[model samples]
Target: MTDESLVRACQTGDREAFSALYDRYIKKIYTYVYYKTHHKETAEDLTAKTFIKALEHIDSCDPDQRFGAWLYRIARNTVIDHYRTARPALEIDDAWDIPDTSDIARDADARQRLAAVRAEVQALPSVQRDILMLRLWEGLSYQEIAQIVQKSEGHCKVIFSRAIRQLRAANALAAFLIILYATHSI
Candidate 1:
């Protein structure tokens, strides 16, 4: 069923329709929340809360808006509220934080790279990172992202373009450091 139909059913208190909606969005919502918060447990909690809040207020949502964007907006707000309450600082861990060097080295390496990228992303002002994440990760169109972020679609495209440039620069620096390390090792 289309999201509109599912939402319409949900608005009338159809439990199965709500479950279907949750099934469709849980992973995307979780991923969006997890990357923003950088905490697994908190992300899980907020993912649940986002859906519950949606269920509670689904009637208030405009039917014309894409349900995915609406759910994402809720997830974003939930994460913001979490940050407001926790006010935790972001910390970068050393490369050796993963203890199992043999079995998990590949996974660890990927996670380390992702962590580095996430750190670079975190350094960006929230608006830019939010736009990048919505566009790149969530596969949201500029128009949809603009709706969620309350910006013009043209402005959203500009923000995403700048964010991509910033990410490219950070990646280039990382690549340069890797080359330096390899040369030093030799």
Candidate 2:
């Protein structure tokens, strides 16, 4: 069923509809939270909290609105609240789980490059970083990102472009790594 129909059913007290919506968005919400938190447990907790908040406020949801964007907005807010309440303890190991490769030297080199790129990306302002991740990693459109970030689509594009430019100006290699990673060629 369409999200609108599912939301309508959920508003009418259809538990199954809510379940369906949960199933549809669970992975996406979890991934988005995980990207922000970097800790599996924290991501899981925050993702659950986001869903809970959505469920509680589902009645207030406009069926005519885009559900995915609304869900992302809740997730973004939940992460913001998490940060506001406490600084998250991030472990390097938790941030990435690269598989073992046959060429140890090549693997080490790639990991080092990836680390540089990650650091550069992390240096970006939260808004720009979030916009970049949503645009590249999540493959979300500028329109969807604008709704989630509560900014104009043109503003999001400018932010994303400026983020890339900053990365390139910081390190050409880092920019290349970002491109490789975004295209899943890394």
Candidate 3:
């Protein structure tokens, strides 16, 4: 069933619908949280909290609206709340695990480049950085990002482009690394 249909069923008190929604979004939400927290445990905790909040407030969801965006907005807010309560050090884990057959030299190079890009991305304004992460890391479209960020689609696109240009200007290597990282070809 479509998300809208599932949401409508959830509103009518169908637990299965909510389960389905959770199943569909769990990995994506976890990844989003993981990227922000950069710690497996915190990401898992925040992701659970996000889902709990979503379930508690499911009645607020409009079936006509995109459920994915609504879920993401919840996750974004949850992360904001977490930061407000506790400013913990971020652990920058390797973005991807290397396969056994991968070259050790290439893997080392990729990790160094990814570290540089991560630093550059963190320096961007929150909105722009979020736009970049949502667009690239999550592979979300501008429309979805706009809804999650409560901005216009065009504005999100412009912000993403500007952020990319800024990154390119600051460190050309960082910009290239981000693209490769996004495509998982690093």
Q: How well is each residue in 7-121 modelled by candidate 1, as lDDT tens digits?
A: 8888888999989989999998988877665556667888999999999999988777888888888987887776555434532221122222323223433456565565567
Weakest ten-residue segment in model 1 by summed lDDT: 91-100
Candidate closest to the true structure, highest TM-score: 3
Candidate 2 lDDT trough over 10 residues, lowest sum: 97-106
Provide the lDDT at 81 for model 3.
71
lDDT ranking of the models: 2, 3, 1
lDDT of 2 by residue, 75-170 (tens): 988877776555345312223322233221223343555564666766677788889888999999999999888899999999999998887788
RMSD of each: 7.4, 7.5, 7.9
TM per candidate comes to 0.74, 0.78, 0.79
lDDT (Cα) of model 1:
0.74
Candidate 3: 10-residue stretch with minimal lDDT: 91-100
Q: Which prediction has more favorable lDDT, 1 or 3?
A: 3
